[model samples]
Target: MTLNTLKATEAATLLLDWYDRHHRDLPWRVSPPMAARGALADPYHVWLSEVMLQQTTVQAVKAYFDKFLTLWPTVENLAAAETEDVMRAWAGLGYYARARNLKKCAEAVAREHGGRFPETEEGLKALPGVGDYTAAAIAAIAFNRKSAVLDGNVERVISRLHAIETPLPAAKPEMRRLVSELTPSNRPGDFAQAMMDLGAKICTPKRPACALCPFGGSCRALTIADPETFPRKAGRKEKPLRLGAAFVAIDSSDAVYLRKRAASGLLGGMTEVPGTGWTARRDGDTSIDAQPFAAAWEACGTITHVFTHFELHLSVYRAKVAQAVACAEGWWEPIASLKRQALPTVMKKAIAQAIPHAFKPV
Candidate 1:
């Protein structure tokens, strides 16, 4: 089916009808019935969910979203929170930069916009970390604006619906145009969410359930074959491997030494056990000579972590001391309370390698 032959209005109507029966009941969303009864979506919740959803899945975001809501009930409360506390709360959620930007955006909304999000996409884009897609999502979902919300799922659905064979990154513009055309001025919020739901539930990436899709008749890929292969991705380059060594120091009371990373660059502003610097070309010093201070350091296996652009292999070492030793920077944290600290996944893995149950809840 060609784009011209696929009646946009009819498709939207069918999708919305399907959504009324099948939309996912999420914690952050206002239902269609609620929305029709003059109940508007909360911009703060929408924005927070959008930010958390970036490079993260819906299932993974729910707990973090709930935790944030419990800790800081409002945007003003979030804005009033200390950056360290926010960072600590946001630990284990990769992409630390987003946490920082979330704080900045909340502060901006609280201070500049008077705790009210900008209703327009343009205004939302002006806030920190509010990119085009996030701005469009917020405007449509929160303010009921007629904005084209093109996320990865929506992109897949559009590419398959029209069978746009152009490889992605290059085909995004065409997909955006198609989305804009299909987006109805009325119920644009529901329309956007409907598209998202259709993509996620029926028009999935692998072995799509086309028989159950609302757009089965209108989808060009279904008319042809292999709807799963519509949005072809560009070739990915091999991620480079980097090496480092982490030092886990423990005193008699079962307290582990931990330190905060610098306020910039990768894994910034997160808690970690002291480690040698990681570089692209060379591995960090793993010899006993590299110990922070004189102690009975023993090798404690190794942990490998994959980042966005690279992979990291760290040689872990553990040292037990009778008394606390002074270091250039950092403090001793009780091993039982290690889970409460702002440790990233990689750091957690390193610690877990030394003390097996360090991260378990008390």
Candidate 2:
């Protein structure tokens, strides 16, 4: 089929039919049959799933989703939760900003929006962390509005189906336009999910199952035999390396001194060991003189963690002191409860390096 013959209605119909048979069974979603029978999806669940899904794989998100639902069970409950508790629950998820905004958005919805999600894209966009894509997704999937949902999966599917040549970051606009044209008014939720499922299970990044694709006959990239190469990305510049130091102070009671990060910037609102500022240019103070309090500070080794923009190498230091040692603004958390703290992956890595069994599951 040619580009002109890429009938929107027919494509949507085919994809929706495929979706009815093969959509992923997720914890947060109501099945198509249930949806058709007037079972509307919970906006809270949809919003939570979308937030967790950002920059995270579905497999990685499943357990976390289930855990959050079990813990809070409702938006009101989440809103009432302590910010520190929420951050602890979000540990290891990465992208700490999302966790912080999740709490803020929940509080806003509970307090300002009466514990209900905004049904419209614009209203949803006003919520913390709900950007254009997230708003569109929630509006369409949870509310069944006819909004065009264009996540990375949908973008790749559209780019391959239409054989869009412009590399990504630049081609996103054209891809959105094409998705808008194809988005149908009826069953918009199912249609949106169908596009995503196709990209994930069939039109994958490599070796797309073209023969099994519902749009095989219509996909322009399939005709050219290079569907994997569509949605091309520009070359990425090497991430700059940054250096820092982490100080792990264990008291006589086997409690580790930890503090909360500032409420802004990377890894904000999360817990960490006291350390020197990770400046943009210089490595943190690696000398024992920079220790939080005088103790037998020993080099525990170094840990390298990669963030989105830079690589961080932290010089790990360990010091065991008496429980009564006066220190800066931080608490002495029992080492056994380390898993319950809102330590980021990098922090966990540093702790593991200093105290080998610090984070081991009991």
Candidate 3:
């Protein structure tokens, strides 16, 4: 049925009923009082998870989220953590900026907001790294507010339900408006989760199982016989390629050389092998410097990684030095202790390849 055809109460009831049986057994959803309650996913937990989940897959986030909670436990604890600690915890998980923001936001809450996460959407939005989607999610799920929650999953569900023909990037605004109108006041959290669950499980991006969807009878895209084509996407731009150089210098103690990235920009606060910016240049003219080296430095191998904005080609160099250099910007970390430290994906890949060969007993 059209959104205008159904009353708010009826729509909410149908969605909630479907949610009761269909919601995934995610660890974050259980209440604090339940015997199975894990870390009592409060607004902080929910907000953190939602932020990290953006542009990240659920499977990949599970271990990282659990590790974060184990290490920090609460927002206050997170605020107390050293920048490097937080970044390391966020390592392997792409989008280094989110990790930096996560720390900045936690500190803001602890210092300015008096250690309590703001309950209102507007208040939450004012904090660092909190955006409309994240604010809405926290308000609805944590505080049981009636705000509409629209992420990619919701977008797909709404697009198919209305048979929207406008390709995505252009269709987002109209979809959000329709979703807001359809969102009900009562049980809004359940309704939002229900829609997300429905879209993920039934109205999936590929070959949506229309037969199992609750709204299949009323779905406009289903009636048209082409649900996947409703919410089309504009052509994507080709990813640009960039190249970087990283140094893997080791001392007699078997400690690997690491440097702290700049406080802002890509992979901030994470530990990494000192390197030069990824640029488009020929080998002979390239100005990339592999941090000051004592012994001869030789190119070991190259690592290719993809980021949201561009592709990176990293050239790894190995060198052995007599003494650990004091650069004010870096430290020597033993190879065994590397896992305890946070390193960006690119850094991690570079280190993974260099350790065995670069640090081998000579």
Residues 113-196, candidate 3: write the lDDT tens digits.
898988888998998888888888888888878887889999999998888889988888898788888788776776787888
RMSD of each: 1.4, 1.6, 3.6
Residue by residue across 3-106, what tens digits does model 2's lDDT show?
55978988889899898888888888897578779676899999999999998999999999999999999999999999888898999988889998999999
Alpha-carbon shift of residue 46 in model 1 (angstroms): 0.5
Q: Show pairs that collide, candidate 1.
A: none
C-alpha lDDT score of every prediction, in listed order: 0.89, 0.89, 0.78
TM-score of each: 0.96, 0.96, 0.89
Candidate 1 per-residue lDDT, tens place, 159-231, comes to 9888888999999999999999999987898899889888888888788888998776778888887888889
Top lDDT prediction, candidate number: 1
With candidate 1 superimposed using the best TM-score fit, by how many Å does residue 108's alpha carbon deviate from the native?
Answer: 0.6
Clashing pairs in 3: 88-342, 243-278
Candidates ranked by lDDT, best first? 1, 2, 3
